[model samples]
Target: MATIAPIEYFDEADFDPFVIDDDVFGEIEDPYAIFDRARANGPVQPGTILELLGAPADSIVAGIPQFRVIGHAEVQAVMRNAALFSNDVLKMNLGVTFGDTISAMNPPKHTQVRGLFQSTFMPKQVAKWSETLVDPVVNDLIGRFIGDGRAELVEQFAKRYPFEIIYRQLGLPQRDVQTFHRLAVTLTFNSDYIRYGKEASRKLGVYFQNLLEERRRNPADDLVSLLGQLGGDNGLSDETIVSFFRGLINAAGDTTYRATGCMLMALLENPEQLEAVRQDRSLVPLVLEETLRWNGPIIFTQRMVMQDTELGGVRMPAGAIVNVSMAAANNDPAVHENPRKFDLFRGTKSHFGFGLGPHMCLGQHLARLEMSRALNAILDRLPGLRFDPDMPKPTVKGGLMRTPRDIHVLFDPS
Candidate 1:
C-alpha cells in the first residue's frame, strides 16, 4: 500500500496567512499543459492558495466562512444547492462597497434582480441583438480588414465583439466604452496589472454612479436604461445596479472574449471536425459545445461550506474554500467519454462549461449566439482557413478565467 502522509492540516482557515502556501495554483491548464497534475490529483486539495488567503476562522476574509476549491461533485453540489452555496460571490471578490448585482444577491433578491436581466437577455432578445447588434459590427470590421487576409484574433475579433455588444447593452457612452472594456479585462484576469485594475474599478464606479443619475433623469432605450427606470419592491437599487454593471462587464467581456477565441482556434485545429460542420452548417451549436469542452473558457468557481461534508470521499469542514475545478471536471472520465479527444460528433449533453444549476452562466445563451455568429462569419467569408502550423501554438491564460493569449490562423481569402 502507498504510504499517505498524515495531513498536517485540512481546515485552511485555521492557518495563518503568512504560513499558508499552495502549489496547486501553479498548475494552470494551458493548451500546453492541459489537466497535467490537477485532474490526476482529484478534486480536493488541502493546501490550495485560495483557502490560505482567508483570515483565521475568527477573522475570515469576510465575516462569512471561507470556501475552498474541491472536485466535480463538490462543484455540482454548490451549483445545485443554491440555498447553501450562494451565488453572491461579490461578497468574496468585490466587497459590498464596490457593487452588487444579481450575481451577488441571495435567494429572493437574486431571483428578482436576475429576472430583470433575463428579460433583456432572453432567446428572442439575444437573437435580436445578433441581427441588430452583432452582425452589423462584425460585417463592418471584417469588411475594413478582409483584404489583409490575416489579423490577430484577440485584439480584432474576440475583444471587439463582446466589448461593443456589452457596451451598447449597458448604454455607456462611446468615449467611455473603451476605458470600461480595458478596465473590465484588467479587473477580471489581468492579475499582473493590479494598479490598472484598481484604477479601472475606481473610475468605472464613479462613471456608473454618474450614468445612474443620468438614467434616472431621462432613460435611454437600452437594458440599463430600462433597469434604471424600473420601480417597486422587486426592482434593483442604484448601488445594486452599479455592482451588476461591474460584474456583468467583467463576466461578459472575459467569458465571451475567451469563448470566441477558443472556439475559432479549436475549429481551425480540428479541421476534419471543422470541415464536417462547415459542410452542413446545422452543426454550429454542436461545434460550440465541442469547442467549449475542448477548451473551456472559464476554468474554476469557488464555494464555501456551511457544514461538515464529504466531497469526492474527502471530508471537509465548514468554511473550506472549495474550487469547482471546472477544467478538471470537464475532462473527468466519469462525466465525458474520452474527454481529451475533441469529437464534434460526440454525443454529450451536459458539461461544466457554463457550469450547472442556478449559477450557470447568465450570459451563456448570448455568448453562444455571438460566438456562433462570429465563427459562421469567418467560415462563410474566409475560405482556405487553417492554423499557421508554422507559428507557435497559442497559450491559455489561467486563473479566474481561462483563454488563449494567441490563436494565429493562416488562410487564403479564397
Candidate 2:
C-alpha cells in the first residue's frame, strides 16, 4: 500500500486563515539581519531573501537571476523606472490567477486603467467613507466582543475586520463575509494550495458573473453596482470589471488583514507608545505611518527586467526577476536613523511600504482609514488593553506576509 503522512489527512477545517501559512517559509526570526548583510556586501544582492532564508524560489521564477534590491534609493529607482523594469511579468504569475489586473500592467495601459478608480481611492474621497463606512464597520466588530475581557484579536478582530469592510463595500450581504474571505485567501495561495485555489477562483468568478448581471438590471449603491454601471457604452468590459474587483479583494483583503494584526502587535509590544496614543488621539496618524514603516505586511514585490539595467552600480541583465524588499528599504540606515527601533515620532514619512511610482497602491487611503478607525475604536472601548499575561507572548512570524500567529490580548470589557 502507498503510504501517506498524518499531516496530509486534514481537511479545510484545518486551514487557519489568520495564520495563512506564516511558517510555510520556515519562519525567519530576523530577516533584516540577512538584508543587512546583503546590503553591507552591496546595495543589490544575487538571490532573493526568501531563498536565502531556505525557501526555494517558485517554479515560475526558479531559474531567473533574482536580485534583492535593499537600499531605499535603489528600491525607488526600480519602482520609479517601470519602463525599464516592467510589472507585466506579474501577468505571467499573478495574472494567471488574477487575470490582467492593473497591477500587472505597465506604462500607458496601466495609467489609462488606473484613472477609472483613481478618484474613488483619493484621500478626500476616502474621508467620506470614514463615518458612513469605516466607523460603523469598526463599531459593529467591537460590539461583538465588547463583553469579553480577553480575546485573540488576530482571529476575532484583525483578521475579520478588513474582510468585513471589503465585503460590505462591495455591496455583498454581511452573511457572505466568511465565504468570500476564505475564497479570497485560498485563491491567493495558488502556489501552495492549487486544488483549493483553482476551485476558489472558479466559484468567485461565477458569483461575480451573476452579480454583474443583477447590478446591470437593478443598480444599487455598492462597488459592484458602480463597476457594472461604469461599463456599457464607452466604459470597461464585464471581464475587466470582474478582474478589477478581484484584484481589489486580493490587494485590499490579505494585506490589510496582515497589516492590521502587525500594527496591533507593534503597539502591544511597545506599551509606552500605546499609552501615549491613548492619551492623545492626534498621534493616531503618526502611529499608523510608523507601523507601516517599521513592520509592513508585504515584505517585497516582484518586477521583471524589461532591458539591461544597472542599479546601485550592479548590472542586472535583461529577463532578470527583481524582488524589491520594501521592508528592508524601510529599515535602511541610510534613510532612517536607528533603523531597528519603532518610534511613533520618527516623522520621516517616506517609506517604500506602500511602494512608489505609477503602480503604487491605489487603496492606500482606504487601508489607512480602516487601520486608524480600528485603533481608535479599540482605544476608546477597551480600557487597560495589554497582552494577556498567561498566554504565550506573541511574536510576529513569516518573512513575506509578516503577522503574529494570534494577537492574544487582555482588556477591561465595556
Candidate 3:
C-alpha cells in the first residue's frame, strides 16, 4: 500500500458523513414505482433499471448490454445460478474501490475467504455479542438524549452504533471512528466520487496495514489479531488481509446504518404498528422483516451473464450485465400480498433483502442482532416515541440505496 499522511482529523463543516448524498447516483423519490412499471412490461427487460426509469446509466455499466430482472422468481433464478450469472460485475466496479475481497470473488476463492471468519459471524456466535457489545453501545447512545425529549435519530444514534460495534470488534481505536466512517461511505459510492474513493481506499489500506502489524506483535483477542495470526501454507497475504478489512468496514457499516434509519422511519410513520411491537416484543423480528421487504437498504445487485440463457421469456446473451432488483422482488405482489403496505404483522418472510445462494450476505446475522438491540433500546428508553409533527416528515429515497436520511421524533423525558 502506498504511504499517505496520517489521517488525524476530519472537517465537520464540509459535509455530514451520516447522511447519504442524493447526487451520488441521482435520487429517485419512488424507485419502486419505476420498478413496478418495468416489471409490468416484462419480468426480464432489455435495458437496465436506470434506462427503464429514464435515469442516466452509471458510467461503470454504461455501454454494456444490460438487462433488468424484476420478478421474484427471475431475480431468485439469477442470484441462485451463480454458475450462469457471475458476480464479476462487481470486480470491475467495487473491486477497485473495496479491493479484491470476498464480495468480488467466485466459488472456491469466495468460499475460502468467507470461511476464515464465517464461524465468528454465525447466528449462534452473533447472539452472544448482544450482552457484551450491542447492549452497552446501544444504551450509551440512547442515554445521550434520553432527557432531551426530542432528537434527530439518524444523526445522533442510528449512524453511530453500527460503526462503533464493528470498530470495537476489530479492536480499532475509538478516536478514529469518524475517520473510518467517512472512508467507508466514500468507498461505498466510489463510482460517484472517483478521486475521493481512490484516496479513501488508500488511506484505509494504510490504517489497516498498521493495525495488522501491531496485532502480529501483540496478538490481541480481536478480528484483526485473528487475521494477523494466520500462517503456514494457508496464510493470507497482507494485501488480501487489507482488502478484507476494507470490505469489512464497508459491509459492516452502511446497510445497518440505513436499515436502522428505515426501520425507525417505518414505525414512526405507522404509530399503531409501533405500539403493537412495543406491547408485543415478539413482533420485533416481524417489524425488521417487513421493513426489509418494504424498503430494503440495497435496492438492487448486479451479476454478469456467463452463458446465453432465457429468463422470464427474455433471452440474455453471454457477458450481459444483469441488474437483479431485490427491492422489486421483495415487493412483488405475486409473492407478497399488499406488498406496498408496511405491515409488521405480515406473515411471509420470503424476500431477497440479504440476497441468496452462494454469495448471500455473510454479515446478516450480525446486522440483525445490531438492529434488534437498537430498536429494543429505543423503545425502552424513549417513552411515547413518535414523529415530530412540527418537523418535516421523513421520506426514504435513493436510486440504489434506500433509507430515510433523518427522522426527528419527540418522546417523554420522564
Candidate 4:
C-alpha cells in the first residue's frame, strides 16, 4: 500500500470567505415548498430573490438574471439539452475545488474523459467490487456497533462505509481513509465556508498529486495506478488526474453517505414500509429509488446557457444561469402523484437523483451497490431494526445536499 504524508494545514487567509452568499447555498428546511411555489407560478420562474438573498459569491447566477426549472419535463429538457444549457456553471463556480472535471466540460472533452473513467465503474466491475469489497466492509462496520444496543448510524457507519470502499478501490492504505474523508467533507459540504473549503481543496490537490507520482514510480493494482499508466498521451495530465481523483473522492465520499443517511431516515419514518422491506428483501431497491425521488441528496444543479433558447415558452438569453430543481421536478404533480409521499411500491420512474444527460453521476452504480449491500447487511445481522425512542428523531435537512444529520436506532443485539 502506498502512503503519502499528510499536509498539516493550508493557509486560508487569502481565500475569500464568501464567494457566494449564504442564501444562495440553498439551505432550506423544506425545499419542496420553494419548488411548489415556483411550479405554481410557472415551470420557469425568475430567480432574482434567490440571487439577492443568499447566492454564493461564486455562483454563476450571482449577478446574471437566473431562472429555475421546476416542472419535470422542463428540468429534463434542460438536462438533456447539454449543448444549449452547458455545464460551465460548475466549471465557473467549482473550478478551484474540482479542477477541469467531466462535470464541467462539454462534448468531445467530456466524452473522452468520461469514456476513460467509465470502464473503471462498468456494471460488471461494480458487481465484482460489490461482492468482493462492499459486502465485507459493510459487515465489518456493522460488527463494530452490533454489540451496542444503540448506534448513531451517520457518524459510525453511513459516513465511513462508502468512503472506505472508494479508498480501497483507489488502493490507498486503510489508515488514510479517515483522513481523506475529513478533507472531502471540507471540500464538498463546507463550500459555504469558502476559506476552509479552499484550504481543504489545496491540501487534497497536494495529496493526490503525491499519490499519483508515487503510483507512476511504483505501479499498484489500483485506480490511481491505472490512471497513472494512461499518462499525458491519453489526455490524462498529472493535473487532470489529480482533479479527477478529487472529483471522485468528493462524489464517492460525500454523496453516498448523505443519500444513504436519507434512505435510513425514510425507512425509519415509515415503519410500515420498513417492515415490508424487512419481510421481503427484494423491495430494498424500490425503497432506495423512492427515497431518491422523494428526498434525494442533491437539491438542484446549475447550468449556463450556451445559446439563446426558450423553455416552457419563456425566452432565455445566452449566458443565463438556470437552476434545474431535480427535487421539485421529482415532486411535480404532472409527473408523479403525491410526489412527497415516500412509497417503496411506487415502481421505478425517471429521476434526476443521478442527474441526466452527458454529465450524469458516473458512480451511481457503485452507490446503489453500496446502499443495497449495507441495507441487506443491517437487516440480516441486526434484527428488529428501528429508531431508538430515547434518542431524538433524525431529520433530513440542507439546501444543496440533504441527508439526515444523524440516525439513532436500536436493534436486537446479536
lDDT of each: 0.64, 0.79, 0.82, 0.79
Best-matching candidate per lDDT: 3
Query: Model 2, residue 384: displacement in angstroms?
Result: 0.9
- What are the runs in model 4 whose C-alpha is more than 4 Å off? 1-3, 7-27, 48-61, 189-192
What digit string (tens of lDDT, one per residue) describes model 1 on residues 173-248?
A: 5655554665676554222333444555666777776776767677767766776765445566777777767777
* Candidate with the greatest TM-score versus the true structure: 3
State the displacement of the C-alpha of residue 255, model 3, in Å, after optimal TM-score superposition.
1.0
Ranking by lDDT: 3, 2, 4, 1
Candidate 3 TM-score, true structure as reference: 0.95
Cα error of candidate 3 at position 378, Å = 0.7
TM-score of every candidate relative to the true structure: 0.83, 0.93, 0.95, 0.92
Tell me which of candidates 1 and 4 scores higher on lDDT. 4
Write candidate 3's Cα lDDT for 1-414 as tens digits. Answer: 122234543333465444447767456778877777766688888888777666656887777899989999999999998889998999887888778777888987777877875777899988988999889899999998999999999989988899889888887765678878888877767455666667778888878888888777777778888767653366567878788888878777778888999999989889998998888889888888888888988878899999999999989899999999999999888888888889988765888889999899888899889999999999888999998989998999777777787899999995
Of the two candidates 2 and 3, the one with more favorable TM-score, higher being better, is 3
Please, what are the lDDT tens digits per residue for candidate 4 over residues 283-359? 99998888889889887888898888899988889888898888888888788888888888989567889998888
Q: Tens digits of per-residue lDDT for model 2 on 154-234?
A: 888887778777777777764566667877765555456555655666667767777878777777777787777767684
lDDT of 1: 0.64
RMSD of each: 10.9, 5.6, 2.5, 3.3
| Off by more than 4 A, model 2 | 1-20, 23-26
lDDT of 3 at 374: 94
